[model samples]
Target: MSETWFITDEQAAQQALEAWREATVVSAFQAHQALDDTGYIEAVETVIADPATTEKTRRAWNMAQEFRRMSPTVLELAAALELTAAQVDELFEYALTIEA
Candidate 1:
């Protein structure tokens, strides 16, 4: 179970998004430290197996879901969740957004 707290800290959310985005660069070896030997191979296999994922998250996930990867974004998730990307990004749009 998760603790429920009603808080509207927009700045905090923005900061969180920044962290997630940075993670994106590191995972792809475009920036930051690279993954260890085993993990790197595993990741490459995952991506090649399914090179489809939300553009934002494709880096961390092995591959995008077959059908879902077609259009990866909060908009797509929103479609599944019945919401808009813009409406979702502020809440979930960070570098980690791709991971989720």
Candidate 2:
């Protein structure tokens, strides 16, 4: 017999939405891979090339082991990419699902 979940639509949506709200960090690879998967690579390249981005932020972007949600680089990128808070949350959540 097949197993079935008894979750209702509202419950499922709530659960999904709630996930990763508290997740503030992910590996750099996960972040990049998520962006690539979501077709944001070119946009990221543009962000990297933007003159407003400081050398420190570029260095962090290129070399950091992990990315934090509240970091300046992330905030800048999110703004440049026009990603809403919900989209950032979804991106982080999706990034977490990627295999190393």
Candidate 3:
């Protein structure tokens, strides 16, 4: 007897995205909170005002900005993962609402 299991590319991509989101966002949020407590907002502003800044601070500021803009649509997520429209739709049926 033989058993077969089938999984589409869309399913695989969706699963990967879901896992990535959970891991990345959760840690980013925690780091943001810690930075927030330490006057990180002022630090970001300072870096922005000054053309010359330490690489460490600039990296941190960039990370904070990236996390702030973390909202990902199905299309954006799909593009990032190189998923086709059909694959994205298979995982994100709700994307149809945006199309209409």
Candidate 4:
């Protein structure tokens, strides 16, 4: 028989909030996959290819091992992606669940 574990709604909410708070960083692969799954991969690639994006930002995007939720580049990219604050948070939350 399979075992089951259950948590109260309040406890689940607290755990989810904690996970969101702790998910400040995720692997580059995870980030990319999350974007792809959400249908924003092409949009992000377009933004990266835009001439307005700085060379430094492009370098970080192309080479970083992990992405930080609040990094300047990420914030800029989120804006460029036309994602609202909640959307950015959701993306990060989803990315955190991804395994390498």
Ordered list by lDDT, greatest first: 4, 2, 3, 1
Query: Residue 60 error for model 2, in Å?
Result: 1.2
Candidate 2 displacement at residue 75 in angstroms: 0.7
What C-alpha lDDT, on a 0 to 100 scale, does residue 97 get in candidate 2?
A: 90
Which candidate number maximizes TM-score?
4
lDDT string, candidate 4, 1-100, tens digits: 9999999999999887767645589899999999999999999899899999988889988999989887888889998977887798899889989887
Query: Candidate 4 — which residues are off by over 4 angstroms?
Result: 1-23
Q: Give the higher-lDDT candidate: 1 or 4.
A: 4
- CA lDDT of every candidate: 0.37, 0.85, 0.45, 0.88
Which has the greatest lDDT? Answer: 4
lDDT of 4 at 50: 98
Candidate 2: residue 38 Cα off by (Å): 0.2
Q: Which structure is stronger by lDDT: 3 or 4?
A: 4
Off by over 4 Å in 3: 26-100
For model 4, the local distance difference test gives 0.88
Flag the better candidate by TM-score, 1 or 4. Answer: 4
* Model 2 bad stretches (over 4 Å): 1-23
Q: List the residue pairs that clash in candidate 3.
A: none
Give the alpha carbon lDDT tens digit for every residue of 1-100 in model 2. 9998799999988876655454568999999999999999889988888898778878888999998876788888899889998888888888889889
TM-score of each: 0.22, 0.74, 0.27, 0.76
Q: Write the per-residue lDDT of candidate 3 for residues 49-94, one digit (tens) a residue.
A: 5655545545554564333213442233334345565553333322
Error of 1 at 21 (Å): 2.7
Task: Evaluate residue 1 in candidate 1 and report its C-alpha lDDT on the 0 to 100 scale.
Answer: 100
